[model samples]
Target: MKRILFVLFCFAVTSSYSQNKISKNKKAIIASVEKHKQSLIKISDDIWALAETAFEEHQSSKILADYAESQGMTVERGVAGMPTAFVATYGSGKPVISVLGEFDALPGLSQKATPDKNPLKKGAPGHGCGHNMFGAASLGAAIAIKEQIEAGKIKGTVKFFGTPSEEKFFGKIWMVRAGLWDDVDVNISWHPSASIEADVQSSLALIDFKVEFFGQAAHASGDPWNGRSASDALELYTAGVNYYREHVKPTVRMHYHIQDGGQVVNVVPDYSRLWMRVRDTKRSGMLPVYERVMAMAEGAAILANVDYKVSLISGIYEVLPNREGGKIMQSNLELLGPIEYTDEEIAFGKGIQKATGKPEVGMDSKIKPLEPTREHPGGGSTDVGDVSWNVANINLGVTTAPKDTPWHSWAVVSCGGMSIGHKGMIYASKAMSMTMLDLFESPDLVDKVKKEYKERKGDEVYEAMIPDGPPPIDEVGN
Candidate 1:
């Protein structure tokens, strides 16, 4: 009889243990995200439908702000003097985790999801970068976390940052300059891509500048030698830069195009402009070369007898990899799983690829992961690099469009408003939310990330490379 009682007691104890484990797992804050997947998909679709452009995402901002506010978050608008930038905060305490969201469309990428290329509206802007999914996924994660906090399931704050003008202007750079990320413990961000992976790499430090030359306009044939040509100055500048390229470091990249080079060849062109980008591994390394490039512009103006103006439009620092934050985000990505394409989605991706005459359905998976503390340079630039300097940040990418679908093209734009894009957005949101939960549950992780950031930063302070003045956000194009 005693042996029988012992067996029953042991069974009861095991059952109780299993039940407790289930309860604990149910309390996992990431479940909040899974529970609200449909809502996230809807939000992503709505933002895609809006299709607002950089610095002009009023509708996108409104939609995000309204949703955040509806979820009981305190919404602050017009951050850093950017009309479309905002911050939505929830929860009242320490361990602040920020999720960065970008909602900017590319110009001249208007397209509808058809087998052949077709635009919804010819010459209209479209979300070629899938920023429509970006803002929505960010808001979705924020809302889910807010729900958990309200339910007493978690203890921490979540902030959703609506950053605009990611395409043309550096919205996050301006926000960083305003010290918006100072109080945040860590930042979690992701981009829609052709795969699911944590970006454990650094991007190139970049600086955008515009050079304008002023000259007296005169009729070419009538006033023969009387006119000083700004067009002549521009040509000289281009030549000088081409010559200067050989002297600069191999890693340093410089590219530019003439924005305006006189309207008529018959007239001594009085106005000419050049837009240029200078990039390198580090801002410090890039500065001297940038100075030389500027000197080239001055020499061009001098030779042409024209007044020259150089304007620093925008700049972004290289991404500082935080081991702790990256590991946490990557583990979450593993948990969230990669984006799975449906039959229709796969067909859509293939259709876009066929239309573009690209060989693959997704980006080449050849890009390997970076070693710890080592940086891998991306050919492109992002405002997120600016935020990384101030906060413990981790970024990831999930496949959304077809492989080799050059960004800011109709091919990308066509898929941006479809299911394939929405699936990637949802996957990113789930990963971001899970990463945030890991941070909230383990404060030591946040500390470790900060320590890594400090060790990487050394004695250097993060100064804005874009100059002391604010960038002109109101300007349409650079």
Candidate 2:
């Protein structure tokens, strides 16, 4: 009995000591991030200016990879069959904490830092979703964790994943397929948004594919009866998709872009292509919806008397948010407190809001109450959703744009290039850094996080929905 009591006492003492250590490390992480803010901002702005699109972010990837190398982290580039995807690591052993970074831009969103829609370059790519800030802030956090590891305040691994092509194609899908996340115990990722909050939400499962219709070419007025127009099949397929929308669940989202129609009014085009995106709250529901669309395409081909082919471009699962991990991140965000905005920043936000036809509520920088992590429906889709299924993941959003600001637009791009986005980037850096420190020092918390992941995931096995072939890196801007 006395020996058991002595053991209990020792355990208490050890726990207390570890808690104190984590507290010290948290402070260090904050300071370390503060130290790197300027460099991070520069890198983010440079990437924004470069505005490279998916699968083509050569210089952007190189910048982040090079910075990780300079920080003494072991950098491995061209991972998971992707030239732009890379990973950086420092330290070793259990409780591996990984941070995800993205540096890809959307096409045709070029805009300057001004409040009004000032195009930097017409029909050029820009950081509409603020992935430029995403990569820089996460890199800053990882560097902070590296500092903690170097100071001996924390042990285990600190990894930064340079994930590219998040906007159009999900880059992390191939990375996960290559087993890059096999050793990771916990993953933390952040996004740039119009509000600051610890997100405990799930994204949509999505499949992006292209349907090509093949037909015979003939003169429009002279031999119209002889030629089977491929454009007819493409139009029918798109119309079917739009009509089927009324029959689907409210959570389902379907969108498409017509890539080709016909060369001229005088001649019928031999080939036409249409890109289709189908999204749902879960993979189980999304699959059936996707299959029905495929069937519709076949029907369209038959009715139009044209051959058709459907090819997978990319696919991603919905995020499985870990509440325990989210709470950890939320606590850190709260501890960091709300981000402050300057009067100029507020005025800039108002101008964008007014121009965009939203209420001029300025910026929303308050630390919101902890949102309950439940299975709920959300609009967008991301490859990070794939990563969440593989490990315990934390999703966070920081206010880089103005309130009610539309994402994936020139307005978002403009705000991200200015002080509004810069301040949020630094705040996310500090918050993520502190959360890593918490996970490093708290083994019990890690155990709980992992156990919860297993319980939540249940016996359902995870398999990536991407095609067997490699990622379509050549199809950038398509």
Q: Compared with the true structure, what per-residue lDDT tens digits does model 2 show for residues 73-128?
A: 99999998899999999998978999999999999999999999989999998999
**Local distance difference test, each candidate:** 0.80, 0.90
Candidate 1 weakest ten by summed lDDT: 362-371
Global Cα RMSD, each model? 7.2, 8.0
Question: Can you write out model 1's per-residue Cα lDDT over 1-478, one digit (the tens) per residue?
Answer: 9999999899677556644543342345456666767777777777776777778788889888888898799999998988889999999888999999888888777778665678888888888888888888888778777887787877989999999998876888889989999899989888877666677788788888999999999999999488999999999999989888888877799999799999987899999999998999888888888899899888999999999999888888888877677777765554444455677777777777777888745433222243465554656778888898888788877777877777777776677677777777776777777777777777898899889888887887888866676557657654
Listed in order, each prediction's TM-score against the native is 0.90, 0.94
Model 2 off-target regions past 4 Å?
A: 1-22
lDDT of 2: 0.90
Q: Report how far residue 459 has shifted in candidate 2, in Å.
A: 1.3
Task: Give the best candidate by TM-score.
Answer: 2
